[model samples]
Target: MSIPQFDWEACINLMLQAMQGAQLGLLRLLSWLHLARDIDGQPAWPFALRLSGEVLLIDHNVVRALVSALGCLVAALLLLALAVAWRRRRWLLLGLAVALVLLAPWPDQALLTTAATPTSFHTSPERFSAAGIVRGEQLYRQQCIACHGADGRGNTPLGLSLEVAPPNLSSGLLWRRFDGDLYWSLRHGKGGMPAFEASTSPADRWALLDYLKANAAGVGVTDTGSWPRPVALPDMALDCRASTVTRLDQWQGQRIRLVIGGTAPLPSEDPRLQSVLLGGQASGAVGAIACASHEATALRAIAILTGVPEERLAGTELLADRDGWLRARNSSGQWSQQDMLCRSPLASGSPVAQVAQVGGSGLDQLIAAMDEEPVRFIKGGFVH
Candidate 1:
């Protein structure tokens, strides 16, 4: 009689079918376990990974299914080898196979594949302007307010449902992150939060950054995202050249120009800035104040006033109108509208000097564009 052929292919097929059936059985058990745990009738599972723009549900059922599939496949192969070894009475082969299967290192390794995929995305160029901040504020109200609260304090009822509470955007912890980092976090949310990349536009993302910066600086930005009337200029003395404690109110009736001192010539020293001032003087309605304060303090003050980032404050100057309303802001030294007020390119390592203009205008065009309304300052104008 011919011995029945031991078909290796049929044995392998039977092992695979057994593995699949075991995996399905394990999955159903997991589902039953989940249903048993839902005493309050909320979502049965409390964990999720936020993907590109959607929540990747990772409830007990999913985790159990994956674990069961991997465990079943490994067990099936090991059992097949052990069966063959037992049939041949090879004890050493069975023992070695069991040892190797027990020592497999799948659980100890980090989730390297998952980590590599999420952080590969990029964000758009940052936009740092007052308008951007206002628009961002509006977007925040519509989308983020439900979780982060109207003040960005993350104290809302919905926020309490998360395993990890959402971070307060206005806190100092977020200060270390730049606009790019902020954009990335917003586009690809972590932990329990959902991603906003698909729901929010690139422009709106930049605006949200501007708004966050402004909010962090303690600006009392309203929840609706409207530009608050220019806060009252604090009574900080301008400390100009040849003038002591020069208050901002001194420039109230005429356009006030505050040029933060830098290597670029002081408004009083540079012929270009002077010529622009002369042009504004010709208009009979120009007031310029040169602030020689420390660069760090000046930057903070400007950030509070206009919501512009400090790095973006390079070059150019600040122009506020007669009613103490901010009219136009320049990013770099080049002023297109003013013919003679252009900032001369500074030689490398040029020394900075403090100079002040109690009354002048290097930006007549900007001054003219100022709102022609009576000055109205918000209460508690600026923080000390």
Candidate 2:
């Protein structure tokens, strides 16, 4: 058999488009399926991923089917548009509407096939930005949508048939690993993924990543698909009143250890962290604190504010996973668009009397941020 010409940039470009179409189709179907006459507010689209420990992990197949169907619809629409214009020698927007409504069911294989076989495929990654996301979408469909699935959920029949499930590029795991890992993976095709280093060019891989983005659902979800954009800050100043003392009431007696600050694996030399065992000495009631933030300068300030001993602070921040995750130590006082600054730990808190307020956020928005042996803190930046 004759070999088809292989162009890395072009194939990925087409794949991106196909994947994008799948995503759009999924969105449209979900939006349509959930549409209802609202008695008062917008219709509730019940497609949220549950975050309870007891809740079993499950797949949203309805959304997946919608994505697949939408991909077909997008193609069908293009064909209908072409057919209408071919006969009339003019644009026919009506075809788009008719194609959209055709997801009901169909024996019309020819018409459907016409839509499925997209004609305008771009190959060059550079051209993608210039030509537009439509080109990017095409590339995604060509190379990735087969394994990643239209929704980015790694649920396609082909992907599922593989021995190891393709990594959900949408998961936090991606952000945790450096981009080099992904590039290497794409080039090498770890495990079941066939290495395309010989075939898929560098430019195409980068472009595909750009279009793929970091999705939580691993299907065709986008950034906005999961988390709402931070509430647009008011143009003018703003104030938010929050309370850190609220959660502290629960951790009254728990000892807070000190985790130190370090840019690399070893965090010993980090100055801001000293040593103090809160309540360890029967006489002095103080605890250690974790200081990882740039400039442990804040730890000293915390020592003075909290009245914890300079010797009581230890230094080390421990977390099973910290990528794209957050941990809140103090969440009191009011903040505004103007005061969007992170809280000052050393600037406040009293340790001599031993009052602790600590909290953490999980890497996954779904997981509860863990509160382990509370990382103690003196007035100094943070001693572990």
Candidate 3:
């Protein structure tokens, strides 16, 4: 009889599979605890490694419950082994237990002392719609303008009089905090700030946050020439000629060229984009779709995103991606890639190189780049 050879390749494959499973389990646990870093936008390791389709369904709640039950079973088995070791006076088992105890992760006292909001309360129910932002602006004027100032820089006389100065809401601070934490602060108040729980409803507080986010995005771009985070184009009702679609969101799955002032001649029609003229007479223009009676509230919200006053918004042109994300802005002259905000990491080549390669207009190059690398936004944050 011939001697059987060991299946080294099969053994190695099994070991690798086991390691990958362990790593995936650890990642799920971290995500459940809200301790996992946002890796959706990253192009590097672990993030770049995608699981096979077979494992994708592991995210389902039923599968997750099964995994949790398996963990509990393993813990029970460990306890059983410990009891057996003690009862049997097994030196090796006791030694292993001591080693595990030495290597176990322990909570840091310093970190423990610091109070943290519950991880369960991380997301906000607010949708950050145009109407919500408009309401938010009204609330800001009523409740926050006294201390935060009209610019949200916290430079008012009332703000200066406080023992602890109000924080600059226009800065990147708004992007750093979780919505739930901000809501908690608004409800309970902090330091010199007064609580609004009595005066403002939950919906009102959320709307206020939406307004602040919009204001911050505009201010950040104005002050630093860059967006603090990716901003979604506020959704609004639209009057499209010869089209049944009555809302801006209905145009999803297609890119949009939004013209604010409508003073200049419309750009050459491109099959790739839908051009909608804002605040202009609907002359039944062939290439461009004219939206009539441009609602002031919608225009105001958009003006905030452009970092310009409503009166100056006439000449502005904005670009929104297929996903309804506001991508670029041009207030004067022709549009260029330099005007793009929330540029994608996956976009290939420098703007100059792209211009040479495409040999097209600046707007065309920007559209191409946007198609190449789509933006990924999640829960008020960019994946990248």
Q: Please, what is the TM-score per model?
A: 0.32, 0.26, 0.66
Q: Is candidate 1 or candidate 2 better by TM-score?
A: 1
Error in Å for residue 303 of model 3: 1.6
What does the lDDT read for residue 283 in candidate 1? 22
Segments in model 2 whose C-alpha atoms lie over 4 Å from true places: 1-136, 214-384
In terms of lDDT, the poorest run of 10 residues in model 1 is 49-58
Q: Between prediction 1 and prediction 3, which has the larger lDDT?
A: 3
Instruction: Give the per-residue lDDT of model 1 (tens digit) for 34-120.
Output: 732331121222223211110101133333343545675577577667778587756666666566566544333221122222222
Residue pairs clashing in model 1 are: 277-361, 288-360, 316-332, 316-333
lDDT of 2 by residue, 1-384 (tens): 999654432332343344445634554565577642221122221233211111011222332343456677777677667777677633455556565667634322311111211111112223212112223345667877898876566888989999998877655444333233455566567878887777766676655544444123213112322121111000111111231221211222332222332222332222311212221222322222221122222343233222233354343221211111112221122211221111112222332112122322221211122222122221001111
**Displacement of the residue 164 alpha carbon in candidate 1, Å:** 2.0
Best by lDDT: 3
- State each model's CA lDDT, in order: 0.44, 0.34, 0.65
What is the C-alpha local distance difference test score of candidate 2? 0.34
Error of 2 at 33 (Å): 61
